[model samples]
Structure formats: C-alpha cells, structure tokens
Target chain A: AAGVIQSPRHLIKEKRETATLKCYPIPRHDTVYWYQQGPGQDPQFLISFYEKMQSDKGSIPDRFSAQQFSDYHSELNMSSLELGDSALYFCASSLDKGTGGTDTQYFGPGTRLTVL
Target chain B: AQSVTQLDSHVSVSEGTPVLLRCNYSSSYSPSLFWYVQHPNKGLQLLLKYTSAATLVKGINGFEAEFKKSETSFHLTKPSAHMSDAAEYFCVVTPPGYSSASKIIFGSGTRLSIRP
Candidate 1:
C-alpha cells in the first residue's frame, strides 16, 4: 500500500530564513495533519485540514502557515525561521468521517529540519 | 482539554520478556486513544486504537491495549519483547468533538530498548 510521501527528508536552514515542507497524503485520504517533534519531546499537533478546508489548529506559530491543495497534498511554510524551530516535522492522512466512522490517521516519514 | 501522559521516558527489557508501556489520558469528553510506534528514521505506525467498541483492543504484531475508562489508562502491552520492537512509542488521544477532523494530542514519547 502506498503511504504518505514527504519532500526533502532533511533540511538545513539559517536563522531568519524561510522554508517549506510538502506532504502528499495517501490516495483517497482527505484529511491531513501536521506535527512538530523536538528532540526528546512528544510530537505536537500543529494544524489540520479536511477536504481542502482548515478544520482545526493547535500550537502552530504565527510565522508558520499551512494549507491543503486540491490534490489533497499539503504544505507547511515557515518564515523568519528561528533556531528553536529545528525539529522533525511529520504529516499524517486519514479518510474524512463523511466516508463513515472515526478517522484514524497514518503518518509519513518525517522531515528533519535543522536551523543553523 | 485533552492530553496524554507516557509514564516512562525509556524502558529496557530483555528479549522474550514482557513489554509494558504505561499511558494515562484526560479528556473533557469520551476520547479515542491510540498507540503508535516509530523506528529509527521511519514513519509512525499505528499499533492499535480504542474507539469505545471494545475495552481490550488487539493490534498488529501481537501488541494489545486495554482501555479502562474508570482508570483513564490505555497501556500498551505485549507478551514478549523483540529486538525489532526497540523504538519510540507514543500514546495519543483525540477528543470526541475533533474526532471527525482527526486532530490528536500525543504524549511524550517513551523510547523502548531491547537487550539481547
């Protein structure tokens, strides 16, 4: 089975720079969620989209913005990146509940972001 | 508010020994709980989930979790530990309101190390 796909498995950026991470969800999955995991910490929920619409938001920073495209893929764009932003970014996808029952997300290989 | 707590930051067990990872959750409403595993440089894999159907949920790879509402605990357990099971495990919770959107909160990960 095809799993979620993430771009730029590893990224390095300097402070005050900008970066974008992309996620291609599994086929037929209409919900996408983003999470950030700092070293030795838990994965924190950032934001989520359902059927191309922003459905919920968590602790995502103001400098970060995300959206799901018509293709069901999503992107997280960060600006004025700070050293504290360095962490692993993960994307997960699930079929929306309109399809019935509860939604259980499946995650993709995460992108490791390093700020220098 | 919804949150999950992983009681241990790390656990070590010998091969063939029993494995236990403790988790506790707090939610305003009925919650859906999950266990996910992450191997080094790999994506998160869903081990099992509790959606109010059964108290004892059996997952893949002989892993199982029991949802005890009265105790507010959903601990993952396995009969025997394997070297391949050495990885980080996360306890996750999603409140009823956001279940459709698949928004979830994760606990601080517990890194499991297996000895030969």
Candidate 2:
C-alpha cells in the first residue's frame, strides 16, 4: 500500500531563514496531521487539516502555518527559523476528514530539520 | 480530555524472552487506542488498535495487546523478542467525537532493546 510522502527528507537552514515542508497523503486519505519530535522527546502534535480546511491546532509555533490544498496534499510553512526548531517533522494521513474522524492514521517518513 | 502514558522509557529483553511494554490512558469518553512502532529514520507503523471491541487484539509480527478497562491499561506484549523488534513504541489515544478540534494524544515513547 502507498504511504504518505514528504519532501525534503533533510533540511538545513540558518537563523532567521524560512523553510517549507510538503506532505502528500495516502490515496483516498483526506485528513493530514503534522507533528514535531525533538531530540530525546516524544512527538508533539502541531496541526491538522481535514479536506483542505484547518481542523485542529496544537503546540505549533506562531511562526509556523499550514494548509491542505485541493489535491489533498498539504504544506507547512515556517518563517524566521530558530535553532530550537530543529527536530523531526512527521506527516500522517487518515481516511476520515469530516466532522466524525476517528479513522486510523498512516504516517510518512519524517523530515529532519536542522536549524543553525 | 484524553491522554496516554507510557510506563517505561526503555526496556531490554533477551532474544528468546518475553517482551512487555506498558501503557495507561485516561479519557472522558470511549477512546480509540493505538500502538505504533517506529524504527530509526522510519515512519510510525501501526502495531495494533483497540476501539472498544475485543479486549484482546492481535497484530502483525506476533504482537498482541490486552485492553483492561478496569485498570485503564493497554499493554503490548510478545512471546519472544527479535532483533528487528528493537525500536521506539508510542501509545496514542483519540477521544471519540465529531468536533473538528479533536486530536490524538501521544504518550512518551518506550524504546525497546533486544539483546542476542
């Protein structure tokens, strides 16, 4: 089965720079969720979108924003990056993307972001 | 609110020994629980899920979990450990709801180490 796909498996950036991460969810999966896992820490929920609409928000920084496009793909935009932003970014997809969405989620290999 | 807690941060077992990983959860409503295993540099793979069905759920790779509502625990277990089983495991809980803001809560992961 096809799994979620993420671009820029690895990224490096200097302070104050910006970066964009993309996620292509599994086929027929309409909900996308983003998470961040810092070194020696568990994954933290960032945000999620259902059918191109922002559905939930977690501990995502104010400098970061995300949206799901018409293609059911999503992008996470981070501006003014800081060293603390370095971590593994993961994207997950699920079948349900509407009001009732308790479907199982499938994850993508994470993008390792290293900010200097 | 729904939350999960992993009982241990690390566990080590011999190749032919039994393996156990503990998890406890709290949810105001009926919850959807899941166990996911993640290898280094890989995405989280579904090990098993419990949705208020059978208390004993079997998964791939000879893994299984028993849900105990009285104890509020869902612990993962395997009869024997394999080298390939060394990885990080996460316990997750999603509260049942149709609200768009509902999200999954992840527990601090447990790192399993297999010794030959």
Per-candidate TM-scores read: 0.94, 0.95
Q: What is the lDDT, from 0 to 100, of the residue B75 in candidate 1?
A: 97
Error (Å) of candidate 1 at residue A83 is 0.9
Output the TM-score of candidate 1: 0.94
Model 1 pairs in collision? none
Candidate 1 lDDT score at position A111: 97
Q: Looking at candidate 1, what is the lDDT of residue B43?
A: 78
Best by lDDT: 1
Over 4 Å off, model 1: B100-103
Best by DockQ: 2
Residue by residue across A1-116, what tens digits does model 1's lDDT show? 99999998999999999999999999998889998988887788899988899988889999999999999999999999999999999999988777773568899999999999
Candidate 2 docking classification: medium
lDDT of 2 by residue, A1-116 (tens): 89999998999999999999999999888889899989878788899998888988999999999999999999999999999999999999987835455568889998999999
Worst 10 residues of 2 chain A by lDDT: A94-103
Tens-digit per-residue lDDT, B24-85, candidate 1: 99998889899999998777999999988999999999999999999999999999999999
Hey, what RMSD does candidate 1 come out at? 1.6
